[model samples]
Target: MIPHQWYIVLESREIKPGQIVGVTRFGERLVFWRTTEGELVCLRDKCIHRGASLAIGKHHGDEIACPFHGFRYDKTGKVTLIPANGKSSEVASYFHIKRYPVREKLGWVFVWWGESEPTHEPVYFDNVDESFSWSSSRHLWPVHYSRAIENQLDLVHLPFVHTNTIGRGKKTLVNGPVQVVRDGNIAFWVYNEVDHGQKPKKAEDLPPPDFSRQHIHFIFPNMWQNYILDKMRVLVAFVPVDESHTLIYLRVAQKFVRLPLLRKLVDFLALRFSQVVLHQDERVVITQIPIATQLHMEEKLIPGDLPIITYRQMRERLKNV
Candidate 1:
């Protein structure tokens, strides 16, 4: 994971009001809960004194009580009360666990995973708004988050991997995939065609990007958007669970249908179909060697891999910042 960036770790619906949930994210055991007033809180799951998991403890107002010895902790992970020491005793300063800064945006839970303070809010696609109705689904992949992200940027696998669906036209020749990078994000246009004994064009020779046509947008770290149409889009968040696991949160958003019930039905069916398309890519992505990707690799690259190459290059630069 890149330091100092807000990484989406879970969906807002996963944790209900007055509910405390325990989950593993970023290779650490974590506990998340809402206070009586619905304020979000996150902390390490372990107790500092006895090494017990605090997730199973009871909630006392804005604080959580350790189940083992009845030690009470606040949202800041500081121990407030030790039952054995009586009510008048003051807890030591060193008896505390780690606390993480959390925020909620567009129905997603984001956590600050770096040593320094967060500089800004998480970056999201600006075009999507509340006017669009969306349906969401989750999938767990046995590969690193980087691998899952690159799969969406890859343009050469459509004809061979998804031949029956989106690649039905069998457009084997890839033209310039014009790309633009700004504010640590990438927006690119795809121009592919069928082979008729003609050479492919380079990105430099292609015309300027046509926003009126189909294009794809990606934000640094972990968010992607497939701009299928102005009113219809596919959004994905590649959440890291550990070094070799990723949880994909996929959503289909549309504004064509206005009726509430019919809109829901349409969103559901569209999401189901999107799942089919994603599974087709999943089957091959999981089998990739080394499970993770880096800026430099041993395999050869082609012109059609311009998006993937650009992603890697930018990722390398951001890892240090």
Candidate 2:
């Protein structure tokens, strides 16, 4: 997995104040919970003592009580009470579990993917927040997270994979598909035209574009968005469940219609449409020879894969950042 970036691994509603949820993400077992006041907390699922899984433990009023030893821990993962030494005993400073920086935002939960402190907030779409209405769903893909992400970055497969849907134009020839990367983490590209037998132009030969039409942007680590318009777009979180599994959280957000019932209707229909498109991409992605993609994988590439090329390079760089 790429380092030093925030990955959306869960949905906000997945954990309530009095609950503890545990799942495997980024190839690690993690347990997530919230304080009584609703602040999110995350830690390595394993208890330092005897390697017990903290997820099965009970979450008392304000502390997590280990089911094995009744050792109580606060939101900081610091032990406050060790049942064996008596309830009033002072806990040793070394008695603590590994804690990770976490946040709940834009209908998802993010976990920092490094050992150091987080320096920035999780990236969010320009205008996506409480102002927009959205419907979300999660699907499990039996492939590496990188494969799932590249399927979206791919531009050359549209004509053959989604011919009757978004690829109806028979745009087999990918033009410049020019790219712009900013802040070292965000990259966007533009190209949505049908080929007319004209020789495809190189990225350097393309002129400026109006980014407002349809934007495809990716944030390092594991997030991407397709800005279809000012008020509608699709956002996806490629959550790494393990090297061979990924859970994709797909959300279709819109604000063009704000009425109560109407907003829900529009968001629902959009999500349904997006699912169909995602399934089409998934069918072929899972069949690739190698489930995961590497920066220098053995494959012949062409100009049509410029967006994917940028992604692979950036992913390699981010691993060191």
- Scored by TM-score, the top model is 1
Model 2 TM-score? 0.95
Report the CA-based lDDT of candidate 1 relative to the real structure: 0.89
- TM-score, structure 1 vs. true: 0.96
* Model 2 CA deviation exceeding 4 Å by range: 190-192, 204-207
Query: Candidate 1: where is the Cα deviation over 4 Å?
Result: 204-207
* Clash count list over all predictions: 0, 0
Please list all clashing residue pairs in model 2, or write none if there are none. Answer: none
lDDT agreement with native, every candidate: 0.89, 0.85
Residues 237-277, candidate 2, lDDT per residue (tens digit)?
Answer: 99999999999999998889988898888888999999999
Q: Residues 1-321, candidate 1, lDDT per residue (tens digit)?
A: 778888889999998887888888889889999988888999999889888888888899999998899999898889999999999999999988899999988888999988787888777888888888899999999999999999999888889888998777889899987888887788888778899999898888888876556788889889899999999999999999999999999999999998999998999999998899999999999999989998888769887888889888888988977
Local lDDT at 166 for model 2: 84
Clashes (candidate 1): 0
